[model samples]
Target: MSPRDRALPDEPDESGAASGPAGARPGAHPSAGLSDLSIDLTAHEMLRRAHVLEALGPDWDPVAALRDEEAAHDLLYSGLDAEQRRMYDELVAAGVLPRRGGGHAAA
Candidate 1:
């Protein structure tokens, strides 16, 4: 399901205001309840990891990084909260990852 499929009740609808409080009225927080516009710690970490991964020269290998299962798990799981961890686990279990044995896919 899309991120919109999972939204908090208190979240805003579309605009920039919040759902309520802080002088926010209903439908005021257009940005609220919108996970697509939100950014959490996990998202930040994933972007950072992507940058690091990209920095690895094309000629250089990704085996070391991918084979370090513990580190990979830790890196990916580090900033995730309970719900995020659950989603990550679900994704892994569902084989959303392109590689087997938790290693990076061969290019």
Candidate 2:
């Protein structure tokens, strides 16, 4: 390696390749994976879950709906990365999930 290439840099490594990100160390911000708290589920899956959540809003309880709605079993709870899953739960609890579809029948 050239001298310049071998020179140790002062900057902390944030690239999550090879050696892993510096923030990946224990007690760091959870994991080395990037997260903007965006839902990472597939577009189709997200849409479906949002429809389900909204359709059953207010008077609807998400837990029971998950039980009643076959597709919801793994919709928001799974097929998502850790951060997204956390955000999904928070959105559900806060009842701010998308209300694209009008009602359970609409969903």
Candidate 3:
């Protein structure tokens, strides 16, 4: 879910007063909620997060990012030297890598 979907606590009630713990005073320290492990983001931090999200764009897909990373790793390791290929063959024979091509047919 996007960050905007997150709900902030301590929202004001219809009376415009900050609704918090029943006994909370009007000017109580903001850290009163820290004991609950809740963190209040600074304005600068929130802006930074917004900037990052904007840069990612609406079309960004986490699954696609993972696929791109895997493709990059495969390309980087695609060229195995003769000795490495021999070891890879041995490992494949021993079921270390499970099976060659990982069940995907070659292009």
The TM-scores, one per candidate, come to 0.26, 0.22, 0.37
lDDT of 3 by residue, 1-107 (tens): 36665545765443334466555666788675455556677988989989998999999999999899778757755777777767766776877754546632122
The order by descending TM-score is 3, 1, 2
Using TM-score as the measure, which candidate wins? 3
Candidate 1, residue 104: lDDT: 34
Q: What is the per-residue lDDT of model 1 for residues 1-107, given as tens digits with 9 covering 90 to 100? A: 36667546886544434335555446566555445555569988999989987897577666775668756755765676777757766776787843344533212
Q: Residue 39 error for model 2, in Å?
A: 46
Alpha carbon lDDT at 40, candidate 1: 67
lDDT of each: 0.60, 0.57, 0.67
Can you give the lDDT of residue 54 in candidate 3? Answer: 99
lDDT of 2 by residue, 2-100 (tens): 555543476443333345454466446655566668666698898998998788777977677666775564453546766775676566667776432
- Among the numbered candidates, top lDDT falls to 3
**Better structure of 1 and 2 per TM-score:** 1
